[model samples]
Target: MTSLTLALDAMGGDHGPLVTVPAALQALKSNPSLKIILIGNQADIDPLISHADSTVLNRIERIHTTEIVTMGDRPVHALRTRKNSSMRLALEQVRDGKAAACISAGNTGALMAMSKVLLKTLPGIDRPALVSCLPTVSGKPVYLLDLGANVACDSETLFQFAVMGSVLCEAINKNPTPKVALLNVGIEEIKGNDQVQQAGQILQHTEQLNYIGFVEGDEIYTGNVDVIVCDGFVGNITLKTSEGIAKLLVHQLKRGLNSGFFVRFLSKLISPRIQAVLSKMNPDHYNGASLIGLRGIVVKSHGNADEAAYLQAINLAATEAKRRLPEMINDRLESILLDINS
Candidate 1:
């Protein structure tokens, strides 16, 4: 693999340097070709990596910044006032081609706002969508998009999202013709809002995409579809709700197993298998959400992510950087738009 550098907002998340520093160290160890630029206060981050060997230390660089975009900070406020903040510096690395991608566990709104302003959206894409991978029942990864990036989307925006998601699925999942679906209230044609129906019609007519019909909320993890497109309002709720349900199921199973001595004895034998299944459904594995269709790759890690979870986010940025996902999406959209115009 070729060497690539990633810019990290080291002080962006809840745990700040404590989580990001350790995660960067782990990522560097796992991927020898990877270099990370930690953007944050030098004093806070130096202590964490000070003891590392020269080989590791050589690959890591730090950019000092004293400002932070807090979780409560508004997007406009951060953009206008926090130009020198770690988050902004991290994105600037990508904007200036100093880094292949930027990953942050910072304020979602601020990150999105700064990214769009600094990196800009790709041509043919009106807005960038927040897309993430989710483990499916078939053990494949399903891509879901618009996860709180744009709460309201028209049909044309939804079509662009499908195009971006489809390209992403093909690039990351290596599916030649990924099955794309629109998330709707029901499978029937008469069931959804006008935007969904119109978008479905547009997708169905597009020969370039393998656009399937509507899918309900329950089908997200069915693995029948490779990309599921929805507005941010619904997508965010579905993602959070699915994560909550997975955690609840694991908790309930453990509680039930411990309720009786006989069950507990059987749990000793069955616990490993159950845990293996639960681990696949763990949200940490899916912590990074890509803000797709931007000129530069930007991944938003869960604000509360721990070291391991944040590492997953870094890994995600690495993969997308290697794949040149934004270029692929732009090419695909251009081809599709040209075909439609013709």
Candidate 2:
């Protein structure tokens, strides 16, 4: 197998090299064919490398950058001022074909802005959407798009999201004809605003989309749909809300289990099963969100992600790079456009 190189913004996340470097090393352990280009201040990154096994060290390289894009930095500001920052350098690696993909846990706004400018959008794509995998009840994951890329979208944009999202699911999840849905207030025909309803009309008419009608927010976890499309504002809110609720439930369940001696004993008896379920629901396992529609693959890790979560993001980038996801998306997009024109 050919080796895959990923460019990582070592200074992007809250913990910078402290978290990203360790994660990159851990990811390298699992994926033998993977190599990483770590972009950040050498003073900080060199020490982390010094601690890694020498064999693992051979697969890693470092690029030095003095500037850092903080979580509080404005997207526009980062674009103009931080041209040589770790984030921009990492993206440049992908754009220049030195790396197959780029991963950052920096400011979402800045990453989106920089990636769009550097990588550009695929032909026939108006704007890139933030896509991510979410675990569903059927044990199959649902791909959600426009997680926060475009805050407001038109009917046409929603249609594009569905197409891009479907292609993504097919490429990564190996679902050839992933069921697609428009997230809305209800399942009724007249449920959503003009954009959503109009988008639904287009989807229903489009060929080979497998477009299901409107789906409620509650249906997101039901595994009833393989792909859920929505404007970024709604999608972002929905993702964050779901994550919060999942954490809360886990916390409450632990409290209940520790309430008394008998309860604790029973918890131990069922701990294995409970842990399996909890592991499936853990957000860390799904930390990478793809900025799809761009010419190259760029994954956004959570700003506050730990080593484990960051490792998941790196693995995601490696998987997509190996799959050549950007090319797959472009090809599928052309087909979808041709169908629309026909």
Candidate 3:
């Protein structure tokens, strides 16, 4: 049996153990053999777990961490000075080989900071990218890269992103021939910047990728494309915008249904369909993003993730850990980089 031990920064998120403790418990119910090293103040975390089941308590272990790396602080400084912080401690567990992977629903900057400084990147990977999957309007999920990691990416970096994102799709999403596209201001190669234009040309020539040229923002929710590549700044904005739009749609749907007798009558007729639509749109479905290209597996969840949200994140972590995602990436990437250089 594979020992799937994961270190979680229980103190790193907005809700802290309030949500973390329950999430951990929920994950355990599904993954019984999973070993967890909760990094947080015992006093803070203990209270949350006190009334819980004995069996759940037995499987989970604790590594008390007092200091915390806040979201607003400078990321690099927080990592350095907050030596005993939960995020740092949790990351160290993976770096030291004590754990297979690390999961955090905390500061994105700090998580990326610790990843770059401690885990390091694989050879030929210029930088590690944050990659997430979002449900498209077409009902399929698309892989979006650099979702706020590397804001300024070059042509070669984009090529690397395609490779990593495709491999990820194959592993988790079962996307055999994952179509790759560059997110442009317009759907044409000529519509993008010099870097993007250059990347478009390069992707067209790359044999490894199923490159499909350029795509626009609206096309993302349509699921016409599989991999949407962009710099972190663009990807981040696009993701947040999509989230906001989804929320707005849900908000309007709720209001429209609750107004009056006619509205309520219409709502009853459309309730099932609307619920099905909203269920698919729920952020929990795509709750985890892999910090790809690092020496080890590191997944980041939303800062305000709830129990079910973290459950999705942990499911991702467990799958990757069992498959030994880090080792697999290293193996597959080594020969590719070598071939490119040769």
Candidate 4:
């Protein structure tokens, strides 16, 4: 593989440079052809990488910026005012072709806004959607999109999201015909709101997509479908709620395992299997969400991600960059649009 550079918002997360710097270095170590541009306050970043060897230092670059977009910052404020912020600059790197992709663990709203402005949406893409993968019963990834990017979406926008999601799923999972579905209250035809029902109608007629019917929340992890499309409001709630449930399950299991002596002995017998299952279900393993439909690549990491989780985000960025995901989606959308217009 050729060298691919990723720009990182080093000061955008809760731990900022403390977490990002180590993850960057570790990414470089794992992928020899990877280069990183750390965008943040130089003072904080320098000390973290100061003890690194020449080989490591040679592949890293820094663009110093003291400005940061906090978690509390509004999207409009960040886009209009914080031009020099780390998140903005990191996105700028992708826009200018200085980086193959940009990754941030910053304010979600601000990051989404900045990325849209700097990267811009591709032709025929009305809006960029946020997409992330979840573990499934079949052991294949189930891609979910529009996770809090646009709170309200029209039928056409939702259809666009389904196309984008399908393309992304195919690219990442190598499934030629990824099954797509709309999240709804029920699998029946007349269950969803007009927007969802209409989008489903559009998708059904689009021969370019493998449009399946409605899927309820219970089917998200069933892996029966590869892509589940929804408006941002519903997608965000579903994602957060799933994350909470996963955490609760893990915590309860660990607590039970540590409880009485007899239980502890029983736990030892089944601990390895349970731990293996838990490891696969860990949220940190799936910490990055791609902001799709943009002209360039951008990944949003969890705000409180640690080095391990942040590294997973970096890996995601690298995969998308290598795949040239944006160009792929652009091409697919163009083909689909031409077919519709014809």
Task: Predict model 3's lDDT versus the native.
Answer: 0.85
| TM, every model | 0.96, 0.94, 0.93, 0.96
Can you write out model 2's per-residue Cα lDDT over 244-279, one digit (the tens) per residue?
998999999999898889999999999999999998
| Model 3, span 1-342: residue lDDT tens | 555788999987778898888888888767778888899999999988888788888879999978888889788788779888899999999999998899999889989998889899987788999999888778778999989998889888887787788777777777777899988989865798887888888777666668898988888878888888998989999988888988998898798789899989988898999898787678776799999988888999988778888878888988888877666667766766666567
Clashes of each: 0, 0, 1, 0
**Candidate whose lDDT is highest:** 1
Every candidate's CA RMSD: 1.4, 1.8, 2.0, 1.6
Candidate 2 global lDDT:
0.93
Global CA lDDT computed for model 1: 0.94
Flag the better candidate by lDDT, 1 or 4: 1
Give stretches of model 3 more than 4 Å off.
Answer: 265-276
Tens digit of per-residue lDDT, candidate 4, span 241-289:
9989988988998897889999999999999999888877877788999
> Any residue pairs clashing in model 1, and if so which?
none
The lDDT per prediction is: 0.94, 0.93, 0.85, 0.93
